[model samples]
Target: MNQLEQLKKYTKVVIDSGDIENITHYTPYDATTNPSLVLKAIQMKKYEYLLQKSINYAKKKGGLKNQIVTNATDKIIVSIGAEILKKIPGVVSSEVDSRLSFNTEKSIKKAKKLISLYEVEFGIDRSRILIKLASTWECIQAAKKLEQEGIHCNLTLLFSFAQARACAESKVFLISPFVGRISDWYSINYSSNKYRSSLDPGVQSVKKIYEYYKKHDYKTIIMGASFRNIKQVLSLSGCDCLTISPELLSILQAKNKLITKKLFIPKKIYAKPIKKLSHSEFLWLHNQDPMAVEKLSQGIRQFGTDQYLLEEIVTKNM
Candidate 1:
């Protein structure tokens, strides 16, 4: 078996791309797209049709220019996700606006509206979609409410154990602990050579979260995401899932290499008391983690910028 084939034995592979066409070739179980990817896709002639179609739909619905454009942008996300769902047999993680990342009420409202849009446009069931939210406290709270209402969520940009613990407590469907971003921070602030597969900061972080969740019998899925290299992907081999880019997936497909499962699925979880943090404690802990604090904010800002760029494209088309 090729590396991709071998890797699939221990973990579910999810394609992290907005190019729906690429997803068919990789045959990933799921496909994830964010604002940046959507923005890039908007410029591609292949996905250009999706942008205009959504814009026409939004304009026909009749709203103010800003409102119409915003609606169109959201519609495009759903349209692409819907098409992805057709190609991949599993869930399509469609993200909500990053601008609403910290707004609990607005995030919840937009998530629900996105769900409605998908059902109306493609008749895709809500059960098949994972609404992606930034792992802010507000977003986690929103996820709690949405989960209760049968809207499963995939928490993104997750960095710290505090976020992981809170998401587990909230019973989030999945938490994507970023591997590459964490490694990037370590490489810049510290040293790159210090972190490798066995000792990789990103690998260690996911291992910690996975062990914690397993030890506590938490059902929240752990998906190692944002991998910078194939090493990071293979490092967390036994994770519930890994969202990989098509480029790296192709790399794995070409290599007839061995995939040694670094992570063995934990059974007979360790006995320990799980601490539930108060709101203040959660805030303080989150603030204290330098990498988490910096990366989380930076990620939100970057996504927001990409979302703004996508809005521009939508507005001009409208």
Candidate 2:
């Protein structure tokens, strides 16, 4: 079996792309999309039809320009996700606005709206969707409420142990620890050679989180994501899931090397029962992790910018 076939035996493979065409080729179990991916896919001629359908759907609502543009952007995301769901058997994570990462109430409201679109507009069931949110304390709190309401969540841009701890405490459906982004930070501030080993900083982050959850028997899933290379993807071979780009997926499919499982459930639990993080503690711990603090903020700003660019495209067609 090729590496992709071999890896599937250990990890649930999720395709991280907005291009429905590419998603079908990988046959990934799940699909994930963010503002940046959606923006990139929207510009493609193949996905141009999705933009038109979204514009028409937005126009029917008959709102002001800003509201119409916002509605259109949401429609495009849901529409593409809805299409990807038809090809993949598992859930598709549709992200909420990154700008709402700091607002708990607004974040909850937006998440519900995205769910409604998938269920009501696209005729897709809520069970087949994972509402993607930033791993902010506010976003985690919102996910806690939504999970209680039977709305599962996939927290993204996660960097620190504090974020992982909070998500596990909240019992969110999944937490996507960005393996590649962590490696990038360390490579820039420190040295690339430092992380050249299999024990890449990004890979180490997921391993730590996975060990924590497994040792405690936490039910929340840990989905390692944002891989910059195939090494990062294969490094977390036994993770609950790994959201991989199509480029890396293709490379894995071509390689015949058999890979061993790198992570596993610990035979003995090391830590005692851990206390849940309070809001203040969560913030303080996250602040102390300079890498987490910088990356989380930078990721949100980047996503927000892509969302704005997507809206500009919609406004032009309007």
Candidate 3:
């Protein structure tokens, strides 16, 4: 069996892409998309139609300029997500506006609105979606409320164990701990050639979180995301889930090699519940971790900028 086939024996492969055409080849179990990816898709001629349809949708709504643009943006993302959902048997994750990442109330409202759009416009059920949110303290709280309403969540831009622990405590459905970004952080701040996949800081971060989750019997699925290479993917073979890009997915598909699992939850670790992170504790801990502080803020900025650029595209096309 090829690497992907062998890897699937232990982990579910989720395609992290906004381009629907490319996703069908892998037969991924689930799919994930973010503002940056959605922005990239809107520029492609093949996916441009989804953008146009969203503009038409916004115009039909006949709202004020700001509201229309916001409506169009959400519609376009769901437009792509709806298309992706049709192709994948599992759920498709779609993120809310990054600008609202910190506002718990707004985040909750946006999630509900997105869910409403999926149900009303696309006829997709809530179960078929994972409302992707940033791992902000407030956003997690928003998810706490959203989860109660039966809306599942996938927390993205996660860089630290604090984020993972909090998400697990909240009973979140899944948390995407970015492997590549954590590696990138170490590469910039503290580089070392000795860092192979086994020693890679990013790989170690996910491993730590995975072990903690298993030790505690946390219900949240640990989905490793933002892989820099196939080695990182191979290193995380036994993860609960791994959301991979098409580039690496194809590489795994082509490599006819056996993949040994690198991660295994300890057979015996005393299981105990973790206390939830309070607002002050969350702030100090989040600020305490230089990498998480940098990456989380950096990720939100990049996504927000991409979202604005996408809005620009919608206005220009209309």
lDDT of 1 at 74: 88
Q: Give per-residue CA lDDT, model 2, range 117-182, as digits (tens).
A: 998997898999999999999999999999999999999999999999999999999999998899
* Clash tally for model 1: 0
- lDDT (tens digit, per residue) of candidate 3 on 1-318: 999999999999999999999888999999999999999998999987788788888889997998889899999989999999989899999998889998999999999999999999989999999999999998999998999999999999999778887898889999999999999889888865546988888899999999988987888999999999998999998999999999999999999977898889889876655567888887888788999999999999999999989989888877
Residue 96's C-alpha lDDT in candidate 1? 91
The Cα RMSD of model 2 versus the native structure comes to 1.2
| Best model per lDDT | 2
Candidate 1 residue-wise lDDT, 1-318, digit = tens: 999999999999999999988988988998898888888887999888898899899889987898898889989999989989999889999899988987999999999999999888889999999999999999999999999999999999999989998999889999999989998999999974657688888889999998888877889999999999988888889899999998899999999978888776577876676778777888898898999999999999999999988988887776
| CA shift of 182, model 1, Å | 0.3
Give the clashing residue pairs of candidate 1, or none: none
Tell me the deviation in Å of residue 126 in model 3. Answer: 0.4
TM match of model 3 to true structure: 0.98
lDDT, candidate 3, equals 0.91
- Model 1 scores worst on lDDT over the 10 consecutive residues at 264-273
